[model samples]
Target chain A: MSASSERWPLRKLIFDTLFFAYGVALFADALGAMGVSAFHFTQDDFIQNFSHYATFSLLLTGVMAIVALVANLRGWTTPGDALFASPLRKLELSARPWSRSPWLWQVVIVFTLTIVVSVRVTESSIGDLLDADGLQGAWRLWSGLSQPNFNLLPRALALAAETIFIAFLSTVLAIPAAFFLAFFAAKNLMQGPLALAVYAVLRALLNLSRSIEPLIWALIFTVWVGVGPFAGMLALTVHSIASLIKYYSEIIESVSDGPIDGIRSTGANAIQTVWYAVVPQIVLPYIAMTVYRWDTNVRMATVIGLVGGGGIGTLLIQYQGQALWPEVGCIVLVIAVIVWLMDTASAYVREALK
Target chain B: MSASGSPLLNVRSLGKTYPNGTKALSDVSFSVDAGEFLVVIGLSGSGKTTLLRCLNRLVDPSYGEIDFAGRRIETLQGAEVRSVRQDMAMIFQQFNLVPRLSALTNVLTGQLAHQPTWKSLLGLHSSTEREAALEFLKLVGIADKARVRCDQLSGGQQQRVAIARALYQKPKLLLADEPVASLDPATSHSVMDYLRKANRELGITVICNLHYLSLVREYATRVIALKEGRLVFEGRPEEIDRAWFQRIYGEEARDVGIQ
Candidate 1:
């Protein structure tokens, strides 16, 4: 017998215990529905309305049990033997039968359950989504967008400029800090256990900082700096610097060993070796990474402003809350245009550098 | 050989055993007089590299005494070792030029041990150093390509640039680790010819690791053969014959001539 067969009995025992516990809980709930329980644990309303789907659930459960048993029997049967014994052998697909991929039916069941649960939890109705009331609301938003408020154009431009500036300043602040930290974080530079320890600590710090979103960081900073562009910049700087360290250190680690060897053979000091050999290799990629971070920061800066960290996002949130769809449309348009321009420009620069 | 006052390098009982327990070299005792083209030959992993690196203390010998220019080398550390290294230069099989850098900048980097850190970092080399770099590039016959990025050059040209870089250091001794291993036969000859010029004209003591027996015979003034990290033979290149080849390599290894 296979090694897994030894564990099968134990697994079967665990499954049986779980099934018995579930049955006991269901029976207890049924008694509670009849007001027979001392704890007064009420049954869910779902069971009272079970008449609607009882027949369907019973048939589904029975079929699922049979399918599960067949799938479990797969471990004991070889594909060739199962195929030879199968009545479906003439169909040609039975050469391997169900033995080769016993998990397929389980996957289908899980997927279907997920969809059913999601539909119930979300209370989503496809008919409601396509109804006239929803279509009318969508049309109103579209109509407002088509006739964006030109009067707020100048204000939108100013806020957009401020948002871009915050991103630029934060990215600029992040660059040098990330560049310095990367030396400590890069595995190639971690020569000894102590250096590796330093790398691990620095890596953990970066990961910790990166795990908190820029918006959340902005909320924290807004409390500290009292709500301004500086607070937003601080948030972006902290988040971007950590992320940039991860990118920059990876690039440093991947630099070809040839140049490092050549440089080291010159009797250059550690600093000189890194300056001459490693920096030259990673400079282009570092710049590209920084510019890419700046693009993301610009988008994030706009978002962070919703929490009172001074930018166009503050105005977008205000206009949205006030139901001034026309003003919101103008601000969004301006942001879209600027983001598109930055993306195109950075792409060109990266392409040229490459 | 010239009857020099003293051998330029004196090495005795040099050996290296890696942390993982691979013995790279053992009981390796050798010396080199100035202006000798010494070629080390062996099958791969036979410790020719470990031997060459030991001279400059690049790969520190676990047990050895190395006297270079009358100073104990293996005992030196940090700045002292660096100061000794400033007098020696190395070229590699891969050429090792910064691929994104202009050829001239790559050549100028050889002066890194001598120049102040900011000078090279800022690309502000003195006119004399810049002139010397260009002259070295001219010596390797790649003066016109000084402004070109190293990655854009052919393998031969890149190796030539590497030679120029090493030469620009004005090092008294040059260590070349399989410097022509990656090139075509003709290109190999071209690179080796520049190395020869450096020895003859610059009076730089040369030590190199080589694979091709023919190249060893053609270029080496003195030859040392390694078999399984042990020094098996040391003599003039002409002394290595069919039997010696079988011993240095293996009984079954035929001499594969590259033309």
Candidate 2:
């Protein structure tokens, strides 16, 4: 074995210790839950609810603990497949896959144990998905969805139009705002203290705003602008500016310097230099990004109405709350068609630009 | 343009030490009479490019005075500095014309410093200026390539466009920073011939950096040598004998002919 594999690897040791601690805690909690101790990790109910996966994980944890202890005491590593290799290989040589890559096998076992333990802790189950009562409820929902209410078609179509317009208006509003702000945000163009200060502040603002989801922006705009498609448009516009500015600024930052030097060497002033050298190289890229942003905005516009920004989502949540599955289906279908069209159109436009 | 007995350009104690402590040029002093073809000979990083750039204020000299047309221009700032650059056109090793712009547009850029603010801002050159730019393109033998983007042109063609752009500026001093360094030997001679033509016909004082001593001998009226950022030799082109070449380029450096 190589020295690296022989030594107690830092990553493996850390992982084993952390997982061993979890096993110890689980055992302590279960022992305490039996009323032999005053405190426990949770209630006695948790002990009862612990699945077979946890018990199996506990046994694997015991095996790992023993192996780690032996390895540390003897200045060895992996002790893994090679230790159990003879017996397992005798049964089936290649079938015992760890014979090829012991570390991969170790990682797979650890990750599997972690996933099973997490699934049990979260109380997630296949049982709910297979239950008679749940299946009946799903059947009812499906039947209603299959038979969409045509009586609400006109209203749903109108709301769909409003959703698309909100996306369109916001994307249009964002273009000039983002285009101008991008120049200021680009580190290359922003020279001197005052310009650099603006660059720093604009970067912070863009980063802060971009991390927040458009849905959250919609919620805020609902309160500020009084629940309507206008609020949704404002929300999308704000988010688009943050996103477009980052993309646009990166594009501006990477522009070829040869042309910039050429223009500047000719004694062109600041604005003329950028106009002649920078802008020509950037126009096609900017147009492509705008199309891409519009496509994203269209997808977001359909969902922003749940909080009060009027659109298809407003109708979706309302109908869902009232158990009007057919009406909800109609709105979802409208959203799907518009989002699909925008996706296709933007892809085509961007490809043409390229 | 030799107006009087005084030299067209004079430098005294010129030096530039970059912020990173690279002493690119130091104590470099020389004078260029109007219409003289002066070539600067140095090994790579001997500060030949830095010296030419300093004359046009492309790279600010850390300390020195640059006297141009009987006026001190080293301390001149802002628009005045640009006016000085307008009279000292530069050609680069990489032929730094905007690759996406038409050859005509690239040539027109040379006149931008003298253009009205609104006119240049809108990229609207007057017909006379456009005609003059085309005339320069014709002069450089690339008139047919006026509408072609510079990036589409061959290496030799691109350098020709660069020379045309500099010629259109009609500068008193033409600064060519190893203008043939990136070109093939055949193209190298062609480019050097253009520089020589500009010197003789236009009466433009030329300060060129050259790598090949062969080209320097053929084209240069006078030559200056720099070693480790200090001027080591200043004389006629023929003065660079074999022993001097060994001293300038270092012993064990054999002179090889290019074309």
Best by DockQ: 1
Q: lDDT tens string, model 2, A169-258?
A: 999999999988999999999988999999999999999999999999998998898998999999999999999999899999989887
Predicted complexes: DockQ each: 0.52, 0.45
lDDT of candidate 1 over A163-227, digit per residue (tens): 99999999999889999999999999788799999999999988888999988999999999899
TM-score to true structure, per model: 0.80, 0.79
Query: Model 2: which docking level applies?
Result: acceptable
Candidate 2 C-alpha RMSD relative to the actual structure:
8.4
| Per-residue lDDT over B14-49 for candidate 2, one digit per residue giving the tens place of the 0 to 100 score | 999998999999999999999899999989999998
Off by over 4 Å in 1: A1-138, B1-6, B17-23, B62-65
Error of 1 at B241 (Å): 1.3
What is the iRMSD of the candidate numbered 1?
A: 1.3
Give model 1's TM-score versus the native structure.
0.80
